[model samples]
Target: RAIAGIMVTIPEYFAGKNVLITGATGFMGKVLLEKLLRSCPDVKAVYVLVRQKSGHAPSARIADMVNCKLFDRLREEHPNFPDKIVPMSSDLTQPELDVSREDQQTLVDCINIVFHCAATIRFNEPLKDAMQLNVLATQKIMALAHRMKHLEVFIHVSTAYANCDRSVIEEVVYPPPVDYKKLIDALEWMDDKLVNLITPKLIGDRPNTYTYTKALAEYLVQQECGSLNVAIIRPSIVGASWKEPFPGWIDNFNGPSGIFIAAGKGILRTMRASNDAVADLVPVDVVINATLAAAWYSGSQRYTRPKSLLVYNCTTGGINPFHWGEVGMNVSLV
Candidate 1:
């Protein structure tokens, strides 16, 4: 069944719901927006939480967001997508995220779903910087969500690499390397230079700050489990899908996208990774679909469940295994 112009199995479920999504300008957020608009044309509104950057207002940021190539297909289908997609100014790093009282009240009054995809995803970010974005921002979002009168579900996006130190990953949240609260307290008193000097010792064997903070954020979500309906999605090395939208279409060379694009041009010769290890690249559209499905799942069972939180390991290792070398050659040839 199709509802509000979206092709979905459960059309009536989200036909006219007001949803709020953070990280609207990110890679996956763009795909999620396209999917929802194309499938659910009847959705009442989508309030995107974006920061006021470079002195631009929230509306201006949204205007630029919709004009991006990611929304080109949506524009073709509904040339006036701006009418449904609304951007709300917010700074996740701020104490209260800089969300005005009016905006907060607006969200509480209307929002039914919240997708928290905003976070600093840099692999080399400093400890303090990473915590500011990944951990503190999450806590602030939860605080706001707790005040929502009509909030149904909050979906937090986390990386599968949060537990990369383990040889095999599980579907449950793992204990972080350090006591998160203690770490935060220490960082609060320490100078930036002092924090940087001890980052290596603090993080231990973790490859980078991104993974370290994400692990802590997972625990933070657990602490708020009693109050908020949340789900944590851990996606491993998200890559271009084999199908959907288009194959071989990718933007940015930060993650495996870099390797794929490099291999395509035959410029990137070698890289670091266990050749035989399973490649867990998931498609953007697939993850977005799973996210929406999870939201619906959480919403439908709200009464019976106890402010539930589900953790999904979005990996293709057990079902289908592709090696890095195989992907390299495949991208090079086919």
Candidate 2:
């Protein structure tokens, strides 16, 4: 069903519910946070897991996040929007997510929903680092979610290219290239140089460590969803905002956003891509909407669909398909 159909009363579903979000500083995470705050004004609280980056503390970072232009509408409407957002100092790369005991207990007691969006998106990231952040971190989060007494839904954000080894991608958890457990055990004692040397062979036909680890992470998440109301959202080549807060409200130079910017500035003169290849560019707002709706649907249908993981292929190609040739033409015009 469409997100609009599933979530007829979006605010009613979210009202008085506490949401815990990871990667609240990232592009999609920020938009998710904004939508929850702006649309679900009655939401009890939003707890964000953040680590100190650069010289800024987690609280300082979240303060800066709300102050960004993305939250302008929320700020104008509800000047106290920031009050509902509580930042918990936590590191995804660490064991148990480095969430303090007090914060962990608080989350266990109060958090009603979780959005696990924190992941290293760098395509060229080292295998060990990617596994640590993407795979192990997810495992830790799942463990935490299992302990959450009041948890209603657990939404994990994965990429559409996770199973890109296959052309026809489906909304299901496919078998990973390698057994994640064995791979993690092997990498434990292996030298970094040796791992780097064999990285290409290890990844096989997959493009990068990012997708490879994400696939492993999905497998792990599926395995751990013993009794949890789990849902996975796989968004393809997320681009600038198409609606909601504003159009073209993009900050980072990752994915298509970077390409569009480089093309506009004449930095990306030409690109090599098959004309017939699908350009599955999904808007950030649409992805967030689907994510929120998935959370709501999971909770509402808990009895009807007990413990079954719902995988949403939040892509545009299957519905409104576009080709890379059109993208090139548009970039050229830019």
Candidate 3:
């Protein structure tokens, strides 16, 4: 049933499977890629959908990603690990993900699994940009997934804060604040100034544009479940690695990583929080593992399971709960 506590058949599920991954260069995405390469060694190929960033090509970026310290163990164990990671130049914000005709055809013909992780995570991002990257891009990816000749599973990565307005979170898609289609159509012709004026009201009780659009994106993704195998993984405040490639492996200052860094630097003097409020800090590796598990389940259990989108609320609050008072104390000690 399990090998070293991991499901024995999970690795077998990915064997010789062609995986198409978006956001391959992001925090969680990189860890997901590494685990797949290191654990699922027999995987046919990992097609990373990337774009030209900071004047560097996708291939160059991927080469640098594989050389990072996170993949040190993997590189040492399997020197040819990079061979399976194939980078395909594409932009999520563009039509058809800005993938070339040749690459598009290749994806449609061979890609068996899809991981849509690319999105604008900035909390202060403009509504239009967030909608474009989060909502519209998701729609485009779903359309593309439908065309995949051998597609078995489509895993979408969303944030746990997507429905933060609600106190009790569950593994389900909640109603959006507004109709996604109507909002998209209304914002089509609105100028930047007018949209900005109404942005706060549009987002309503939600904290930021990021969560708002992400919720809408989830709704849109669910609409495509009838046509393809779909699963959504909502991770809460993803922190550094737990025990996969290495311990304390973190690259970005996005969530708790930033707070930890600031505390270490002695820059974070004081913080305010309800002492008893639950701090849901799920590690990046745990999220990736859950993602892979979801993929395997979607593929192998489709026939036995009901015909509906699977939503995995990958959080640790209910199981191993930690409070902010304890977190602050730990950080202070550190």
Candidate 4:
């Protein structure tokens, strides 16, 4: 690996190139942003799409995000890193992602890379909300990418479980259960009650609306990318960081992290799962690294785009070192 510390080509590809990222404040998004600045310090600018939340304006949220614990090392090193993070007001659930005319124009003119990370992750999110955020939002972003003058590559973050309806998962986009357009049009007339009533039926053998829509989003990406280079990253059961951006860096208490924390604190907890069953838990940073590398590969040949779609399924299976019982024992000892 370059003789133990040589600058690599991934960073070189990003050097002086403007990058646009949605979901910059989310868990994986934060790590991706920090890594881009820390590893590719010469990147021209990172335009993050942010919408007002909890009474905080887009700019305020961006400021707070850059100053979070995640970016401590980055701040210590590159004091001017904040200058490179430009916040663009946006709401993915709205038309055109709620991005302003001027901002849209700016991105169209200058953006080199686009990372679509914003989505409704809540498993219980309503069907209508899920469709708006997951499927239609993808289409809106694709529309924006089509108009970009300097766009090199578009990276879409999807879930590994998106194709859970299948017996065996492969590194490819499976055909969606239903036509995205017909369903979207149907939802327009149906109220939440109607949508919820038929949510399970509509999802059809898929576990939740989240996975169901993600599958549709993948198919939509393939259809809408047109001539733009595109790549998709499917990460399963993303957990805390293994290394990079500091160890044990995680804010959410989901999956294994939640179980261990509650168990350690003597919170009344009993769960059902076979210890021997493989947990496809992958580190967030590892996913980010794979995503960045895929971006480079997608746009390597700017003129002649070789791969129209690069799909990466980031998950752990087969033989694995650790298991739930072993991990639980260690946490209890602590």
Candidate 5:
């Protein structure tokens, strides 16, 4: 049933659609890029917003990106698949995201959908840096999306733990402890170390600045209201795929999953998390598929309730209910 639905929906609906995916170099982003290309072969173009890193040009980055093993299937199908990939150079931290006027105009004229996945994923990122990348970057993206004349949908890939302070998290935007604008202002003026030192006090109950700022980002999206067709996909800790392409094929050993790997290798000693605590992990492919579906659904079903933003909590907690101990055991075995 799932395979039939994907076949019926993807190419027929997504073909020739101009998509702009940020953070195309990241793990989840790579998976998304591969899936789209392999599944929707005729996709008009994929405009990936990438920053020039280590003196490498945008074109060079694109060249390196397509050559990755993730795009092996696409490479085999269409060796010239690189042509359909338009790499746009833009820095997230800059005002207007540093996108050139000409490039911005090009995006406005052509882009139909946007996947905003770029962000500082580090749990220990400085508060100021976190605000700049996670919060301010999102604001800048929203501004750019507003100018996209042909934009149909804007999907924000937010974390499900953004509302972790609450016991039973809901599909809704929870207010942050600090005012978004005030926090931005404070971080702008204060020293990085000072901000980092006070972060714990500032973000009460919240584990780190990452989740706190992400929650603020959701609020900013809500501020968009009637202006844009938006969907907030709050996915739990993304794990190895259950289907599509392959299973248990993970790359970077980051997040809690990294801890599991370390524990399995006998590298990690003591653990902090409770053994029986629910490990809310949703597969990367599932999240990508759900995001694609949500983007389509959100576009067709416009929200009439302006006060409430569309939040879909994608997690196994409500369904599978796997625990941390189970995850540890699985990692050890696999």
Candidate 6:
């Protein structure tokens, strides 16, 4: 979007900036990683923190991710695109995130932006596990961000359902039901059985531990962000791409695609759901775009604004024009 030959500020801001991303292997994480590399071509480098998965090392996982069909468009544009990604070994569940001393020092010295995208997305995740990944890991990341000397902005990819207990969702970070400090302490001493036994009562009105812990994580971010330029992007029901890299681009069978696929194939018959409910499904690319733009703005010109927490609810709100045909076809048949 060059007006008189000047590059657009959003892409321009990302130029020459080193980025550190957590959860670079998840569904939305893959899209975010790809989009950052493709869109911000001149960006210095992308450091992705990855834990070993399914007997694959962090480096191997990163290679598999870049080689996936999702990066076909990106690979065509830049044949050596994979060279820009540097996978750092780190596990979110471990103490201090398992980030080694040298790597931690390197990140502190060179990282310009931090995107904490990792989280346990399971709807039925145990309270202890969810709090560990979503809340405790976030707390550790915030501490790490505080140490980054060149950090310009920190963007946390949160779910729109973080505040699902509310009837009307707002962009503001709502007050969490429990104090994260107390919860963390309790989880340390409390047995898994006890936590599971109290899960229903702990989550209260929320459907699962996912949302409850996410809400706690958001609150922790809000409290810990301090003077850092930070933005929390809460995307709802992120589905396939609308039209960035490609249309109908989805990697996983989780989320709405699973239900839609089953119904489309006449496998899922008469699933219980209200037609009147708002299915707030957002595209993965859209969320990535918003996240990029938000970082640019948060880092560039928004410094003068009263450090008010910036939260973006990136969702269709059940009223988008792009969704009717797709939903009508997939869901109506069921």
Kindly list the per-residue Cα lDDT of model 4 for residues 265-333, writing each as its tens digit. 988366677888667788899999999998876766554445557789888764344666566677778
lDDT of 3 at 64: 87
Per-residue lDDT of candidate 6, residues 250-330 (tens digit): 988997888788777778766666666667888889999999888887877554544788999998884673443356565
Every model: Cα RMSD to truth:
3.4, 2.6, 2.7, 3.1, 3.5, 2.8
For candidate 2, give the lDDT of residue 228: 89
Q: All candidates' TM-scores?
A: 0.92, 0.95, 0.95, 0.94, 0.91, 0.94
- Summarize candidate 5's per-residue lDDT along 126-177 as a digit string, tens digits: 8888888988999988888998898878899899988889988878777777
The lDDT for every candidate, in the order shown, is: 0.82, 0.90, 0.90, 0.87, 0.81, 0.87
lDDT of 2 by residue, 81-126 (tens): 8889999999988878889999999999999999999999999999
TM-score of 5: 0.91
Off by over 4 Å in 6: 1-8, 321-334
lDDT of 1 by residue, 1-334 (tens): 3345554454456778898888888888877777787677778889999888899988897787778666777788878778998788888888789988899899989888889888888988988999999998898888888888888788999998898888888778888878888888998999999999999987788899999899999999988656678888888877765554555445677777887777788798778887797777888877888888878777766666544468888877778888866877688675
Sliding window of 10 residues with minimal summed lDDT for model 4: 1-10
Give the poorly placed runs of model 4, Cα more than 4 Å off: 1-8, 302-305, 319-327
Candidate No. with top lDDT: 2
List clash counts for every candidate, in order: 5, 0, 0, 0, 0, 0
Would you list the clashing residue pairs of candidate 3?
none
Candidate 4: residue 215 lDDT (0-100): 93
